[model samples]
Target: MSTVLFWFRNDLRLHDQPALHAALTSGATHLLPVVCLPAPDERTPWCFARVGPHRRAFTAAALRGLQQQTTVLGNPLLICQAPPAAALPQLAQAVGATTVVCEDIAAPYEQAEIAALRAAGLQVRTVWHSSLLHPADMPWPASDLPGVFTSFRQKVERAGITPAAPLPAPAQLLPPLDVPAPVLQAVGAEQGAAAIQPPAPPQGSDARSSFPYGTPGCDGSEGAVLAHLAQYLARKLPHSYKDTRNGLTGLDYSSKLSPWLATGALSPRQIYADLKAFERNHGANDGTYWLWFELLWRDYFRLLHLQYGAGLYRARGLSELPLAQHNQRGFERWCQGETGEPLVDAAMRELAATGYLSNRLRQVVASYLIYDLRGDWRAGAAWFESQLVDYDVYSNQANWLYIAGRGTDPRGGRRFNPTKQAQDHDADGSYRRLWGTA
Candidate 1:
């Protein structure tokens, strides 16, 4: 029987897995499921060090969960640590795969990998699995997506483009194929480990961490995502998300879904489905169901990046607006979390110490770095790239552009006044004192 290989990237769960479903449908008796973890390279500047330790640990935990699920499905998820572009082709040949199926990733690097595999004369099928709604169901083409979020939301809402129902997992395990382990380590060996400090607290600890989630890092699994959704919905958290989302402290302040969305461990559609179900179970009110509004904001940024591509990375991003030059010392101070303002510094410190920061603080600190500090937003973005576990490229890049007066925000250059924000959000000085303010 012919074999089809399912390449697991961010979409980690078997339930509602479109790519895995496609692979299994190929009339192949033997299924090969593989995960490629890239070895950390310091020179890359975008490797594990930039990704921070907290997320790494969280991801490892998620990966363990995925392994368990895959085992129950009767196929061992082959974990390999190597650049997928370099390793996947060889693995495909070794396994004698007739076709390759994977979740479509919009990022440039991920797109390049799929193209490279197709160039090697293999049948590669990609599925849309990340969006809150599938691209096909949208009233507009992906290319025609509105540059402004409100316009996009209005058009979609007016058209009533409800998201497709999620696909269900196979009832029984797909028969496992006898294949050798791909030449990659699931965890780094001592020789390959980076020189780094100990990992920090997981997101859901309620330990007063700036950014809190149920777990840490990208573990390549879906169970953690399910747990977080269940808890947040049971208590009807979405109804209050818009109000508390801007809060600087406390566990209930934000949705904390970014990390899962960032790693593809949870799809936006899945989150939306759960949110709607919760609304049905309870009742639909602004306070109870507005979380999806926030998610649409996330989707807006994603579509913005997809529309403009590398233009969003330039100094003068989407708007082509001129930006001031970089300030090295200012950039350095901001990265070190020594910006002097108590709230700003505390937020940055929390990110450096825990690889997470609250949404309000993220905007405040980002605005300060770009406007007050006279630093390049890209530098701030790179720093964020190194530190944030939930850092999605689309959100991070587009947000930087918006702050720098170069993206979708019609009111350009909306710089956050850190002192004013600090006073309003942390009036009692509790958050400042907790982070050891001056």
Candidate 2:
């Protein structure tokens, strides 16, 4: 009987999981669902823990949800600690599996993992289902994608390119092979066994939080995200999204879907699909259209990663100019929300406390770091990677590079005047009062 190893990376949820569906329909007599946990102490080049406590907690919750769902489907998830390159080949060998299938990731480090698996003589098959639209469905090749967001958006809109409907989760997965506990334990030991802990109970909602991921019924699980989405739409929140999205506080200010989207617990196409239904039922408005617009921006960043590869991670970024010198002290202050700028400090404190920041505040703090602090943009990006519960590689890097004048921005870098931003977005001082001393 044929056996296949289905490695789960960022795409954690079973619903709308094309890769998972493909693995089930591949006719393999036995299938194993596996999640490779990152080393708890993994540190980045900037000496910051690559995965902070908040993100770790959020990821654990998502995995637990996935485990429960997979168990219900009769194929329990196998949790492992080694990186994909180290763990996958050993597991496949132990189980005598012939094929390894997973979702294709676009980031540099993740691409390296796939390369390592192929090098180990494993027949790896990857499905590109992470984005709203598949790369093949684009009007142009990723290599030839427009450099600017506006140009890309215009071309895609002109071509009338719509995302393919998402695939439903499989009803019944092939039962797991009876690999012995000793063999599994040996493989795990060779790769290092990283313990999976249950996520801590949420800290309850802060009325000042735009994203209350910590609130009850709003934890990082796929079920929580889907329920939250339903509640938002049920209340017709999308109708006011465009106008309220810039607000400094309040849960209704934005969709707050980034956490789920980042973890792949919620698929972009799934979001797009629900959005279209809402527009059909409620009649489309600017708010609804803006949500689609934002999704397109997400797609654009993913495409950028596909186009640039390692270039996106470099100090010089995509531009020919060299970035400013790294200022460790300035960056440290920024990370601690101690930059002495009230607005930036508040935003930073909010991120440090809640692992989330509004889209407007993200830009505001990013601009402050790159322009006002005159710090290396990469340092700030790494800090975000360390702190944000919803950090996505493409969007985080692309945004920092854009703000640093090293990306596709035609006008070069963006520098937001903190005083002006305070006046415009937080005119009432309520947001500052909440996070000022934090």
Candidate 3:
């Protein structure tokens, strides 16, 4: 019997999983579903973990949910501790399979992984399902993507483009490819499960956390992803999203969907559909419109990657700016939230304590690091990649580049005056007090 390997990337959930759907229909009689965890010891150029505790713990929770779902569908999900390039080809060989199917990620590292797999002689099929609007569905070609976000959004709206409805979860997947137990144990196998069961939920979480992940209702599982969305909509929060979105603290301040989106536990298309239905039932307003606006921003960033590729990762990004100097000490202090700037410090402390930060504060802290602290934007981006539970490659890289005036921002760059930002957003300083930076 022929077998195929299904590699899980950022798109983790079975719902609306086009890549998973593709694997099921690949004509293989048997299938092996696998996920490769980032190496724990891997460090970024800044010498910090490439994936930090919150990201690891949160992603592990997502795997546990995925493993459970796959098992219920008659296939067990294998978690590999090894990198994809090393582990996948070996598993494919062991299972007597040559084709591997997965979600297509546009970022440099993810694309490099795919390149490595092809070099290893395994046929890889990558399905693009992460974006809300299909790239092909856009009015403009990828190469001619509007440099500015507003232009992109205007074109999309004028073209009346809507995302394809999310695909339903398959009732079952192909039978598991028979691999010897030794082969399974050789790989990380369920986030290195031979050594431990799925990662235990993180402990000693801060009570003041807006996301409060690793606790009940916030672990990065598909079930929790859906549950959070159901509750957020059921409580009728979309109607007020715009008004509360800028809030600096608490879960109700925003949709809090990015974490699951980052993990692939949540689907942006499904979110879009549900929100549209919500507006129909409850009536459309600026708040409801803003949610869609934000979704467009997410898609815009992904498309930007499609156009720029590795250019976005450069020191100066897409612009012709000179190379930036890395302020090692300043960057370190900013990471620790001890830069003597009350608002920026509070935001950074909250980020460290909770693996999450408000979108408002994210911009503020990023600006403080780039414009005020005179730090290398890449290092700050790296720290966020290591820290955020919802860290996304396209968004993180694009946002950092934009703020540093290194990308397509018409305004050279955004420099949020820390004092002014504090007065505007934290007028009473409650947010700062909550994180004890006051």
Candidate 4:
């Protein structure tokens, strides 16, 4: 029987997963589902763990949920410690599989992994399922994508481009291959093997949290996210999303779908579909429109990556202007939430305690780090990668570069005044009181 290895990358959910769907329908009699855990000692140029404990904990929770779902479908997910370049080829050879299928990530490191797999003489098939709108469905080619977001949005709207409806999870997946259990165990036992365990539930929801991912129905799982989405819509929340989205604290202030969206537990198209449904039932309004608008922004960032390639990762960014100096001491203090700026410190502390921050706070903190602290923006981006449970490579880097004036921003860069932001967003001082100290 022919077998195909289905490797899971950032697209973790089985639902709305085109890559997994392709693998399942590939005419292979058996299927192998694998999730690669990065080597534990992996470090970024900024000298921090590539995947920190907070992100690891959330990912572990997500994987446990994925493993349960896949196991029920008869194909258990294999947790491999080796990087894809090394482990995927070995697994393909071990299973006598000729083809490996996975989601195509447009980032440099991910593209490099695909290159390595091909170099090893294995056939690799990749499906692009990361964005809300499929690349082929875009109004213009990636190379011709608008440099300004407004222009992109206008052109897409003018062309009446809508995202494809999300695919449903397959009811029956291919049966597992007869690979030896000892061999699987040995593969997992290799150095950097993922130690996945269900994370401890959050002690309790802080009344002040904008994103309470630790709450019972809000945990990082496909089921949990879908349920949360339903509940949010059921409460008529979309009608108010535009008004409340900028709120500094409180669960109802924003959709809070980003964590699951980033981890692939939820799909952007899935969210878009549900938003349209809500509008049909409740009437279209700014709140509903803004949700769709935000989804477009997400797609825009992914498109930017497609257009710019490794340029997005460079120190000088697309602007090619020299970046600010790196101050190790200042950067360290900023990370620790000890910058002596109450609002910035509070936001940092909240992020440290919970792997979340409101979209408003993210900008505020990024502006503070880049403009006020005069720190290297890449270091800030790296720290966020290590910290945020909802971190997306394209959005994180693009946003940082925009704030640093090195990205697609027509205006030089954004520099938020910390004191004014505090006054405008936290006039009551509730947010600061909740997280100002440590």
Which segments of candidate 2 are over 4 A away from where they belong? 187-195, 199-208
| lDDT score for candidate 2 against the true structure | 0.85
TM-score of each: 0.89, 0.96, 0.98, 0.96
Best by TM-score: 3
Total clashes, candidate 1?
15
lDDT of 2 by residue, 1-438 (tens): 989999998898988999988898898999988988888779999898999877777777788788889999999888887677877888898888968999998888889988999999999999988899888999788899998898998899999999999778788899898767776775574343245454345542555666666665557788988898999888999999999999878777889888889989999998889989998899899999899999999999999998998989888888888658877899889999999999999999898887788888899999988887888888889889988889898899998988888988889989999899999987888788899652
Q: Each prediction's Cα RMSD?
A: 3.5, 2.0, 1.3, 1.9
lDDT against the true structure, per candidate, is 0.72, 0.85, 0.89, 0.85
lDDT of 1 by residue, 377-434 (tens): 8788877776777767778887777778888778886788877887788888888887
Compose the digit string of candidate 4's lDDT tens values, residues 1-438.
999999988887988999999998899999989888987789999888988877877776678788889989888788887788877777787789989999898889889999999999989999999899988998688999888889988888899999889999999789877666656665663332347764454422555556655676767788888999999999999999998998977778898888888888888988989888988898999989898888899899999999999999888999967767998888999999999999999999888877789889899999999888889999999999998989998899899988998988899799999899988999888889889552
Regions of model 4 farther than 4 Å from truth:
189-194, 200-208
Sort order, TM-score high to low: 3, 4, 2, 1
The order by descending lDDT is: 3, 4, 2, 1
The most accurate candidate by lDDT is: 3
